[model samples]
Target chain A: MSSITWQTVQAEALRRIRTREWPPGSRIPDEAVLAAELGCARATVNRALRELAEAGLLERRRKAGTRVPLNPVRKATFEVPIIRQDIEGRGLVPGYRLLTRAVEPAPAALLASLPAGSLPPGAQLLRLRALHLAGDAPFCLEERWVNPLTAPGILVADLDGISANEWLVQNTSFTGGDIAFGATNADAETAAALDCPPGASLFVIDRMTRAGEALITSVRLSYAPGYQMQAVI
Target chain B: MSSITWQTVQAEALRRIRTREWPPGSRIPDEAVLAAELGCARATVNRALRELAEAGLLERRRKAGTRVPLNPVRKATFEVPIIRQDIEGRGLVPGYRLLTRAVEPAPAALLASLPAGSLPPGAQLLRLRALHLAGDAPFCLEERWVNPLTAPGILVADLDGISANEWLVQNTSFTGGDIAFGATNADAETAAALDCPPGASLFVIDRMTRAGEALITSVRLSYAPGYQMQAVI
Candidate 1:
């Protein structure tokens, strides 16, 4: 019996693509042929190719066979890490300071960003403003509106020692979320927090997380100047 | 005989997580128990759970068993699509115009972005600047440098009608690449191309693609004001 796994088959196929042995726009061998050559099951080869096609690395037609894509629109995965971990990843000390915490009525814009019917009408939200520091330098300013009903623990959680960003990640069980990346001109208040010149361009991330039908939090994280988020494809 | 597949097992596991039947920070049932209950092979259950663990939705410890993550740092996948398709996806007419094409010595910064030893010293690169339009309005400005040696066909490719962004996608086969997203203060030239005021904050994407060890292209895309890149987790 062949003890080869699908991952081994996948690595071998990727090697051929990288080496240009199987050039772009050219059809690769049939699954049965590859299985015979690699001493694996045809099912194993099928599994490997299916994953590669899903990743946009290969193009598979119903009857035309599988070929390397000429222009592959690859999917890049970005992990949304906690701010403290982000700072620590850069070999800097992570510090958090809570700037403000208040319970206020949800704003119309905030309500529009959340899922419809996720929050009750006129529900009050716990708003938090905090600054994350990397080695005594301003790293990011976090402005968050948390649904107290969905995460009741936040109303009583300690905001001085830890950030709402970390606290919610530890307590909430979000089923799904949407995130947006864009650029914003830092206003005077934002510039003061980030310690950048007014009107400087800043990278911003806006996210809304939910647990089932219940909204958990809506947050905007504005990073200091020169912050770049990276990914691989 | 059971007809359960790994996908079916995975869906059931995900449903449990979404419903909070297996609450956060709690260990899920063992593989043997789940297989018996779900009437599937033990290997199927193992495969299903393994995928969830890899996705950061679950935490698996060898001796302690698997538990739902209390603080799941979920990953979001963004697809890098051709600029024309991106415009059309918004239900707008797509237009492209090539502004300039020149062959110039590769700059030190561009060479440093690529993998070391990917380019020979003093090699000339094909530089192309173009504008993408949505319904006759400025959308994005693309500044690209193509390694002529790696993509020789681009030297004579008809870039007037079709953009290098689209043309290269249809011709090049890159194995891996890196992308960075940030904010840039648009200069006078960039602002003119994007139809935005100078010093306005613009979202920028910088990418470097390679085929094995051979660098294929280095490109930067600057999106007009109010542009946002979105993803789901």
Candidate 2:
């Protein structure tokens, strides 16, 4: 009993679910009963059950007790890694080449995608276009717009050496962000940059990070053909 | 003090992080100190800090206290919902049409994806092709292969009214699964089924589910042009 932990209880509960000893749609024992049976504190049992419910293996409703859901919609989590690290993780030499760097007013579409009041009226943003390489081959094309008001350090930062993706991650303190995954056919410019045929299907990730009320940056990465993002549930 | 909860402690910790009071690269106070200051149990403070560490806002090292990360690699979680529920959640009418159904030996590539010993030698799989629609417009094309050994009930189940995606959720109790997102150029058959032009960019999701050692199903869903999956950190 002294050696019992929440993880131990969670493993036992999961084993029961996997073996169908506690079958689907059947209510699991209450927290107090499970605590007594497993020789652990009630809080330990509660924590174990709560985690399983969060993972969609168990269902808990107000005043209805807990049960295994008949149709559980599981969740998959992905760690959004830096592009350079992603390439290096695959045992490839990572390279970056800056193609364009300019300061301009953000487009209306980009502004609409961000949170309201992210930037002052008529504020100029730093725009960067770069290509990431894996083992001397084009990997991904990055198009980014950074709010100078939030990340003013970019004004004098050297773009040739460090990518904005890595720079902001190290310097910025973001409170929250949103991400989206989609597919797009490469236009002529993107195709030329990625060294792929025109209209090739490309996996795309769009992300916007924020610090309190200020928008840190908005960036889009278009991967070369056959790029896949994997996750587990 | 008696009314203090872990949620209360967690909210305070999040506020400190958001406001930069606990700046990046600085170790936070010990759990005992935080508990004493907040008039809560030590376990409650420990739980709150553990969650923040899991969310990538803080870095925790064994024997070294927790500290906010300078370059935090945040995580984004996406709920893998059933296709019908996905359409309905968008305020659209859901529709399904079965395209093909056959029992055949699993393909070599699919067999390689699952865990070892998922199927015995020469086991036949149930292959299904279907189109999911939203508001009379093509939304996605589903290609699924189900191992009959694990899900024998699927063979006798009427799939016309209910998709394998939904049927499996209702009947199967999976222990774990893997998912991947990618992009592909729509082939002729897929283009026709999705009512899009050939070579159109498509968002694709590939998934495999297992119950203990038995593989239940392997599915690939090709979404129509302009479909985007959203997530949050």
Candidate 3:
């Protein structure tokens, strides 16, 4: 045998759990005991166990030690890629067409979600509507709002060369954001853009980004029918 | 002023990113330099930076050092919550009705997804269909397949008191799994169960769980209209 690395420790522990040797909700040996049994340092065992704990397979407490999770709600991590990259990754040509550009008052829902003092009352926000394409077919429709105070240059920025989604990712500085996924029945305007029938179910991704305490942008992307997102846990 | 802790270090770093002090695609100071500047240990700075990197705000390479991510596609982490907990958390009484249960030949898709040698040829699998409820209204419909070889006791187990979802989590030990989210037009049977019109869009979650080399279960959960999932990044 070579040596007991953290990877090997993790694999062995996983195998034991899978075989019911350490059944669900049952406490496992302490880190020191595991380290001694595996002939490894306690730190190595601790690292391995910590990873499993973070993955929702094991639960740990200060004095109670670790136990296999009874109701393990596994988490799936997804990288929310930009529209162009997502399309290009599938061996398709990515393109976009800018449809509408105007200044408008922020909607009530948008105003409610924004942080207090982030935007002045009755401030005009730059609104843009565009269609993303995968070569000849429509991929998604983008509706976005840019807060003028957060992105002062957006009003005069070149909107033809690159999409607002791409531009925002490249130029905007945000510390955090929120995203939501849902299904919506396509209205006439969206149906016309995606070439689908009215009332067809479309996958929608809504996002809001913040730069520190200030809201940067809020966007909604409505994808064509049959869009699916997958992840491994 | 507060002493330099990991939280402070993280906050300072986020402030720099948000203010454009450390612009996108710009290399950040190394751990030793940042530690000296902040009057903290290198490990504290390392921990703070690692958290940012994991959150997709920074990218680190061995020789290249850390830099603000050029295209920060912020990740949204979602816990795959149990249906009962989800309903109960919403202050609704959680209930379920077992619609169908039978042993049948594995479907082609199920057989295809299962690992070779995990099951014998022409094996009978336990298939289940059930309706989960929030109060008296139908919440979602679940269709599941349990590999008999991996879960031998499932054939005769009392599935009425506990849902197959709950039972699997308690009894099965999975090493890894995959999950997918999409929207599907409900078929006649699914529409009947959910009390919706046929061809109405339904949010779907498909999952496959594996225990070491053995396949455990494959499940599809189709939710009623207006179901939405949100996450913060």
Best by lDDT: 2
DockQ (Cα-based) for each candidate? 0.65, 0.74, 0.68
Q: How should the candidates be ordered by DockQ, best one leading?
A: 2, 3, 1
lDDT of 2 by residue, B1-233 (tens): 38888889988998898667998789999898999999988999988989988888888887798898877777778888889989988899999999999999988988887778988878899999999999999999999999877786999999998999888877766877889999999999999999999999999999988878889999999999999998987
**Chain B TM, per prediction:** 0.90, 0.93, 0.95
Q: For candidate 3, lDDT tens digit of each residue in B66-92?
A: 999788867778878889987887799
Model 3 CA lDDT for position A166: 79
In the range B1-233, model 1's lDDT, one tens digit per residue, is 56699999998999888768988889999999999999988989998999899788899999899999876777778888888878988899999999999999999888776767888889999999999999989999999999988887999999999988677666766777889999989999999999899999999999988877888889999999989998888
lDDT of 2 by residue, A20-110 (tens): 7888889989999999999989999999999989988899987899998776778788888888888998899999999999999989999
TM per prediction = 0.91, 0.94, 0.92
Judged by DockQ cut-offs, the docking class of candidate 2 is: medium
On the 0 to 100 scale, the lDDT of residue A55 in model 2 is 82
Better of 1 and 2 by DockQ: 2
For model 2, the superposed segments whose C-alpha errors exceed 4 Å read A15-26, B1-4, B15-23
Interface RMSD of each: 2.1, 1.6, 1.6
Question: Between candidates 1 and 3, which one is better according to DockQ?
Answer: 3
Best by TM-score: 2
* Ten-residue region with minimum lDDT total, candidate 2 chain B: B168-177
Residue B22 of model 2, lDDT score = 91
